[model samples]
Target: MKLFSCPSCDQVVFFENVVCERCNHALGYEPASNAMLALEPTGTAFTSVGRGGDGRQWRYCTNYDHGVCNWVVPGDGAEPFCVACRHNLVVPNLADAANVALWQKMEIAKRRLFYTLLQLNLPLVTRAEDAEGLGFEFLSNDPTSGQHVMTGHDDGLIVIALAEADDAEREKRRTAMGEPYRTLLGHFRHEIGHWYWDRLVRDGGHLDACRAVFGDDTLDYNAALQAHYANGPRPGWQGEYVSTYAGAHPWEDFAETWAHYFHITDTLDTGRAWGFVVNPRVDREDVLTAMINFNVFAPTTTIANISDAWLALAAALNALNRSMGAADPYPFVLSETVLRKLGFIHDLVHGRVN
Candidate 1:
């Protein structure tokens, strides 16, 4: 995430900020330009003071009325929702105030996920364009209807359980599942990985290469999952997989690893935006000396280069969290084998098959 500033006062503004605190300029994210613009309402539409000086009027996404989104749709565009919200097919009933609150939280995470996806310049097709293009459904467990919603991806549609938005509920599940970290954004990244696997690996004619790196995805998924839960993760799983859940099947391994790649690169981008640099004055190991001055999302960034900066900064972040009597910000370790898998994903995302 690049650092944002209010065009009115140049005050530092975070991604989720809707109003510039200093100048009180209303703000909205311009999805086309990937910029947070200070808005000037002109008639029924908004004229961005930042990049769209072309007098291209824009309107906030319909969801913005509910305070759920800050993204804007071009005034001339026919879509009611922004690029991110357009993917949502079914949302929890907002009649219940609780559901509204949960949906708000989910939208925040979802927008952040979209920001990263847009930053990576990944293909984001709507279901209207492709039958298997990306879409979302946020549902809740309804006992009366005997409807239970489990968070998972099918085809190109990703369903998220509304309860997952509750931090306490998510933490309970994390503890029960013996997981190190879990978040709404993490869930988005993981499920979207499944969608991309369909688009990029399975259909993109790189299944053979992906199989070599992630193991044969043709293996029986249900059986693999059953054995995984029954026996737990294999011993020394850390060396090969990003998480114990990743070992369930080759598809999962790819998804989990893909999620981590996003985690590392996006977090590294945030660090860079904050002007963070790691040049330890002590020991100064060669691997820890890489500076984070370059654009991490650039296709030229090698996986080895990413790992170098990621490892050093993640260590510092973990230590900072410990100093504050909190859990490590990043609890996973990347072994050489895992790094190789991440390299494959990096290459794949950049459209390099060889």
Candidate 2:
């Protein structure tokens, strides 16, 4: 979420850049340092050409072969994939060209999700490490069998439907679900929230506090969802939930609120990196005066600071999108209840809470 520069040429490159355009140097993201380093070929491995750890040998994640990833693992490490790619349990069948492209798009979003998680210093254990650790299965619908895959989480495995990669298909589902916004990154954030609920709430012994904020998650999830779909959200649901779907269950409320916290922090981090300042000289409102001068990624950042900056930034962004006749980039409102839930997640991630 921060600006990256090519170590070789000092040219600004993006997080997902595989090659530095200015110097043509190969690039790989180092998760430990949270940097996109320029690489120098050194035998079978590549040496980082960056500060602090220059000359460290590394290898691109195996997913890099499919042109889907640019993350690196230490050359001395036994894993063939980087920290991010290792979570992938099943990638789409690459024999199909369309599937290859879909997987690439999904990886882009997944890596971004990993970036934020890593920044938060959240635990990211693989299924190999823990029997129920976080993992992913990128599956596609089988047209021949008329079977469709749903995007959700079970235990710790997050299933991402490959169909979500297609813009038309995703948009259709978004409309059908009555969602204001939905994307591959959103899916990762939402599904991973379920995994975190298990780890941080159930296993981490924060059930009391979590239930207090998110409502009793013990309520029958399926029945709650069935009732919610049969009878839509309560009037003025925005006052209590971030989205209509969030009103379905206490678990869903937590996941939706958790996802929004990630969205707010990561987007605010990006705003800070870009040197964004929402000072709107004409409107002297105190609420619109965020300067985005602090690091949102820092553990010390408070929920108040994040929400304040995010409200101003989201307003500015929404106006920009409206100016161009586009939908609001961020369409959700953060009510006091939602902010309290977000604060709970913020505390949970920072280890301030169980």
Candidate 3:
């Protein structure tokens, strides 16, 4: 989650920016270097290489032709597709004008997912097989398309209907799920949790470790899923669970915690870049300890933690929303359990947690 800048102009840029606002420079993110490069097209728009990024070769994704992306593939790559596009098992029809724009929105979120995954040093290796590879299917989600398709995951691939990318549909599902916070990025994080479980939880090595903190993962997933649907999470679920679904199973708890980890790090790193929080140098144990003590054992820490930060951030975010006449950018509060989960994830990623 370290800040990124436009390589050409040195202007700070977000991962989702398609065109630099400061210089009006065409832009594309290079995953290998984890950068947003200012593009200098060397050929025609459709068949051109952008003059910047790692190895000095970059080309826009084919979906860009359909207006669904502006990201570049490695210019020298024979595949002629961006990393994100390279993983597409299927993309819904773009001829229908609505699908083009909707898919673009999905790409924006997906790219953000890639940014965080890359930033965290998470392994996102893609494979052709059903069980080992990470992949995605952006489908129409139309009943007419077929009875086989559903918004779910199989092996390491996540299948999200293009429907979920729509504002109304996403909101409807969020409400139906009764989740205080839910969004495309959240969905990506949660799904990737399943991806990583498969990635690192083999040989029952992680079974005991995961169970120690999140509870047993050995429960029959199908039966647990059924029980969860039938009974829902226990009352006052937040006392011990990061999210209601987290109480369902160990795999779910891991996923829920995993999502919160992405949320906290990206937000914290972003806050630091914006000069909202003082950042410390590497070994950051002081700031880490401060954040932990403040959030987890507040009575013991003198410095402020996320609770205080959230209060200020919430006010500012709400005011910004009010100024724009839009909904608040951040929609939920973080509970204590969620905080501990984040700490766990932070340590695990840094190899501090075993």
Better of 1 and 3 by TM-score: 1
Q: Write the per-residue lDDT of candidate 2 for residues 299-351, one digit (tens) a residue.
A: 88899999999989999999999999999989988899989989999999988
Model 2 error, position 177 (Å):
1.6
Candidate 1 on 137-231: residue-level lDDT in tens?
99999999998788999999999999999999999999999999999999999999999999999889998899889898888988998999999
Model 1 alpha-carbon miss at residue 174, Å? 0.3
Ranking by TM-score: 2, 1, 3
User: Could you arrange the candidates by lDDT from highest to lowest?
Assistant: 2, 1, 3
Candidate 3, superposed: residue stretches over 4 Å from native = 1-13, 21-24, 44-55, 129-131, 145-149, 278-337
Cα displacement (Å) at residue 24, model 1: 1.4
Give every collision pair in model 1.
none
TM-score of each: 0.97, 0.98, 0.79
Q: How does model 1 fare in lDDT?
A: 0.89
lDDT of 3: 0.68
After superposing candidate 2 on the true structure, give the runs of residues whose Cα lies further than 4 Å from its correct spot: 50-53
Candidate 3 structure quality by residue, lDDT tens digits, 1-354:
456676666778876677777777788766776667777666643222233443365678877777667677766667766777767878878678888787888888887777677665666666654446888888875567555455667787798778888889889988998876778888888888888777665432555565677777778998998888899987887777777888887788889888876666566556655656332355354322222212222223211354455445555666679899987766555576666665565555544545
Cα deviation at 323, candidate 3, in Å, is 8.9
Please name the candidate that would achieve the greatest lDDT relative to the true structure: 2
